[model samples]
Target: METIPSSDFFIQFWGVRGSIPTPGKDTVRYGGNTSCIEMHVGGKRLIFDGGTGLRVLGKSLLKQGPVEAHMFFTHYHWDHIQGVPFFTPAFREGNCFHIHGALPADASSMKQHFCERVLHSNSPVPLEGMHADLNFYELICGETFKLDDITIETRPLNHPNGAMGYRVTWQGHSVFYCTDTEHLPDRLDENVLHLAREAEVLIYDAMYTDEEYSNPKSPKYGWGHSTWQEGVKVAQAAGVKRLAVFHHEPNHSDDFLDNVAIQVQEACPGAFLAHEGMIVSVV
Candidate 1:
């Protein structure tokens, strides 16, 4: 048996965008942030992804002082890793960061995905100079690992760039994070469903609307993302207790995302949208 948090394990979203950051008037309510999430378990803090949301989360973490951090990256897509250089902790020598990610299918190594100047070289910011003690690991699908009391499982996602989804479990409760995945023949897979089955919460990619994603003219079928309806279907099929619609489309306005949330609730009964600062506790 694993040791669990002291009755206070929680997960919080710091960023929730699909492809890029879209901060502006229309996105303020639901937030146009990118993909970063924080987990607090057994007094340990683990960060998932380092998208634009890391800029803000980094500031908050700086104020909180030195602490160990484990960062999990779904993939090396720009939107998922561009904010690592902006994370304040990376500049502090006292901080240590363990970064875990999925290696590109054809790439020689995972580092090849993020180390080229063609990606972030034009900008003044670069990840190479970060002062923190950094360690990187590549995770394989079906492999299980531990952090504090939590057990984690990874699976490849149906994405053009080969992204991955994660399932984190603690205290016998689970939360599955599936961002930036496209629906293949079906939106959900039995392997993924099994990983998420009876989960306390399932945070999923909800970057398009059924009408937008399924329409012949608008379908982003090859784009590696899904609509709210697809997310609901996956959650229901997985037997998740609650569903969190995450990775909102950059163009989806607050009102638009809100309506999607309502519709997801209508479909799944206990569904909600994942905002920049929302914290969820699962017993």
Candidate 2:
């Protein structure tokens, strides 16, 4: 098995559910929260997506004191961006956050989606009055950028509204985060393959089971999410050492996720399902 680095870098999952946040009796085990993950690199915090889990993430950060944080959004979808307005860190005056993601050329900007309330149109929260210094950058895919000691490489994902997968490398360790993507077992994109190459951890969207993906009642056929079987194939093909299966289906129970994890491990030895509050150290 490939081991992580010794730099003390770690990733913590705040939310792991896909599509919508599931809050009910059936979802407590694997967590019904939506997409949010925190990466601590070189003493700095980097957040991936701001789903409903951001509520908990914000409280945790607030208690830890103000810190410079960056949010790397996969896309402007509701489940991924809805937690922005509620993030406690964003409401603080001295705290700052940089929002980076892909955008449509014809649309005004990614920020507009937040302002227009495509998801939470009735929600009372507003971004204009936030005290944090915010910066928005719409990055082109396949570009590499630096954040302190980390080098981030972005690649466009195979999704409806378009999403970007990020590969962060620093101090001889690398983590590839690519959620909300869909792929076939035998076919893979060169860019995605390159991004996952030699990665210590690959956090990917394995939202559907093989049967669900191919079944008639599957809600996500054309919605752009991969099954665990497909995810395993891609991980193996990309030479990924460990695969963290993410973006669980909203209706899936913890038992279902447990079974899925076992199946994925059988296919690829290092596959595991991402659970709420699950933390992995890369160093």
Candidate 3:
């Protein structure tokens, strides 16, 4: 694993968009790639999801030579796993990746899902062509595990085919990655609250606006996505320090997001919209 000194904790957003990749002039400011994020904590490299942004992140990692990281996936959705085939580091000789994810709803292991399902349809070469030391670790929702000095907790989320949320804590700071989850109408999600309670940062799925979510013309209810307004509620209820409004709606253009940013700031004074290439430090 690539190591860093000190007790620094950082979260970098490689992709912030949700659903699908939207590359165009209108989305240049926020981002075009689907969900991927990187976390550096306690001298360890941690990655969340394998969206298209992972490919871009891979290119940057090449400058650092051979590397190792712990990769975690929320679900096997196409938008989340499409970057696996293009992640350049995975095809390199000396690189290593310890992949982790909750088992598929079906009777398959993490390796089977990634190698057979994800890679089979996307990659041009077989696993043999990828020279990296790849290791897959199966995870269960609501389970807690220790990664060296880091403590990670996983919980189930409300999403189609189910998705998992992760809470990473090291030293005393914590960061919750809770994307692709839908909020309950009657009450806030208790599962999300448990992982995000009093945390330094909560990276949430805010893929629609209240207006967009409930629009009679195109209702987003039960779509496994939440609005930024709901994200603020979760933050306040959990006593979270900062809320990162992530998982941008694919069709939301830069100008559209710029408007949402203002609304988010107004609703939650401490919260801000998450954007591509944005990095937040958890202190």
TM-score of each: 0.91, 0.91, 0.96
Model 3 C-alpha lDDT per residue in residues 206-225, reported as the tens digit of each score: 99999999999999988999
lDDT of 2 at 34: 90
For TM-score, the strongest prediction is: 3
Candidate 3 TM-score over all chains jointly: 0.96
Clashing pairs in 2: 5-282, 5-283, 6-283
**Stretches of candidate 2 exceeding 4 Å from the true structure:** 1-7, 108-114, 117-121, 216-220
Residue 250 lDDT (model 1): 83
Q: How well does candidate 2 score on lDDT at residue 208? A: 87
lDDT of 3: 0.90
Model 1: what TM-score?
0.91
lDDT tens readout by residue for model 2, 57-150: 8988787666688888888787887677778787788888887876667658767754564325665666666788887777788799998789
Give lDDT tens digits, candidate 1, residues 8-116: 5678888888788998899887777799988776666778888889888888888766767888887777788767767778878888887787766666655565555
Distance from true location, Cα of 45 in model 2, Å = 1.1
* CA-lDDT, candidates in order: 0.79, 0.82, 0.90
Candidate 2 lDDT at 109 equals: 77
